[model samples]
Target: MTAARSSFGFKDVDAREKVRLVRGVFDRVASRYDLMNDLMSAGVHRVWKDMTAARLNPQPGETIIDCAGGTGDMARRYSRMAAAVQARRGGPDARVVVIDYNAEMIAAGIEKGSAPEMVWAVGDAMKLPLPDACADAYSIAFGIRNVADVSQALREARRVLKPGGRFLCLEFSRPSSEWLRQAYDAYSFKVIPTIGELVAKDRDSYQYLVESIRRFPDQPTLLRMMREAGFGQAEFTNFSGGVCALHHGWAV
Candidate 1:
């Protein structure tokens, strides 16, 4: 049987090979991943994340899985927000699992110190090591596009969430206008690689990153995928003129 094919940036390769290449990229950039986000987005990523969290509306004693949750940025925020809700309601703190396939990224998150409610694990998005219907909410921010099989990852996301559970995904997306697309393309292609070389010292890796974004499915397609994976009320809200998008679906 022929091996399945996958895109490693613009290049097509063996699906299994794509996994290794992605891992290597994350392993190299894990230490500086958050920094690179800041540099690339000019700190706009933080605001987007905050908006995503607000939409999540996490409650006390809920279990949230932050898949590909590098450096625990959003997971830590969710944990604290849940803890605050618990403090007010006099209930147990929320449990947030920061699960990522990259061990280096997990190590970086650990180095930053985690909240008591936070749990760390190195696991693949397509095959999360968790029981069925085990979580109340799931989130993957700017990370799902990197998965070798985005459909499988979405299926696993549905598998892990209890009925009535919520799932949110934040990912880079195509701009809505031709003018914005032109501007974004110019910035992404000409500027991001140079930033990567100067800041992350990995030009090739950043080049792949840019290519991956272009290769990723757009907002409507992703919403359709979520629906196909058994998520009800699947919808998306574009952020920053569609440079990024936040998708929400409920496992019904």
Candidate 2:
């Protein structure tokens, strides 16, 4: 039997190998991942995440599963939104689960002191360790592109969501303007790895990160994938001249 192939950065490798390689990259940079994000995006990633959470509009007592939620950033943000809703309604706190395949990343989130209402789990996006219809909303921020099989992950996301649940994804996308695209390319290829070396002492991992962003599907293509995965009303909103995008879909 032949093995399936997938991308590890620009290199093609066996699917299992790609997963291992990707996990290794995160393991190497887990401790400094959040810092590197700030350096790479000039603190703009926070704005993107906030926008995603706003669109999610988590309600009180909801169950949100943040797949590949490294360092608990999205989970924490969702928790805050849910908590606000709960306070206004006088309901119980919302439940958030932060799931990551990389144990180091999960450990980093734990060590960083996630919200008391949040739960952390080590799990794969392709096969989440949760029952069907378990979440009111599912989100993956800057993490879906790393999955070896994005389609499978999308299916998994849909599988975990209750009917009428929401799915949100925040990821890098093709820039809308030629000038901005050029500037981003130069920065990504030339500057990001240097910053990675200086801050995380790992250039190859950051290089892989940049390459993976380029390899990810564009906004419309991803929306189609979401629709194909059984999500209804899949749509995307571009951010920062399309340097990033927020994708929304519903399980109806």
Candidate 3:
């Protein structure tokens, strides 16, 4: 077997191997992840994440599990939404559970410390340390493609979601237009790694990032996977001309 690279530059990587490689990269770059995201996307990631949150439509006193949810951004957003819902319904307290395998990212998330109601755990997506039929909703943002087994992760998401629960995934997708796809690929393969080298001081890691995005299943294929995982109504909406997408389904 070829030795799995702890780092690489524009090389093909096994899907299972991607999980470990990505974890290492994210751990090393955790402190700079948010900053680099801002720089790389020119602050557009905030808008994307905001759009994802809005589509989730979280309600009060509902349980949400944010798998691979880095820096607690979604957790914080859900917490605020839950609080409002509770106030409206005169219900019990609601909270968001954030789980990620990377300690560095989880630790960085804890440091942000935005909401008292949010909980953090170091856990894997392929085998989530969560109970079945418990979460009212589950979400993974920009993190699913890094999983060792995408299928298993989707199953785990299904297992933890209650009946009528919703599942949402926000990720990079293939560009719709040929010209845009060409330009996007150019940026991913060239400029992204350069940014990583200059800002995060890790060129190889960004190369892996680019490859993982390329390897990830496109919208229709991913929706099919969601159906295989038992989600009743899997669908996706493309954003930014398919550069990003929001996939949603139900555990009916």
Q: Write the per-residue lDDT of candidate 1 for residues 40-152, one digit (tens) a residue.
A: 99999999999999899888889999999999989988987888888888787789999999999999999999999999999999999999999999999999989999999
* Candidate 3, 81-154: lDDT as tens digits: 77877778777777689999899999998997768668899999989888899999999999998776788899
Worst 10 residues of 2 by lDDT: 84-93
Backbone clashes in model 1: 0
Of the two candidates 2 and 3, the one with more favorable TM-score, higher being better, is: 2
Superior candidate under lDDT, 2 versus 3? 2
How well does each candidate superpose onto the true structure, as a TM-score? 0.99, 0.98, 0.92
Model 2 agreement with the true structure over 1-252: per-residue lDDT tens digits = 999988877888899999999999999999999999999999999999998999999888889999999899999998888888777778878899999999999999999897867999999999999999989999999999999999999999999999999999999999999999999999999999999999999999999999998988998999999999999988899999999999998997
**What is the TM-score (0 to 1) of candidate 2?**
0.98
Off by over 4 Å in 3: 1-17
Would you list the clashing residue pairs of candidate 1?
none
**Could you say which candidate leads in TM-score?**
1
Alpha carbon deviation, residue 107, candidate 1 (Å)? 0.2
- Tell me the TM-score of model 3: 0.92
Superposed model 1: Cα runs more than 4 Å off: none
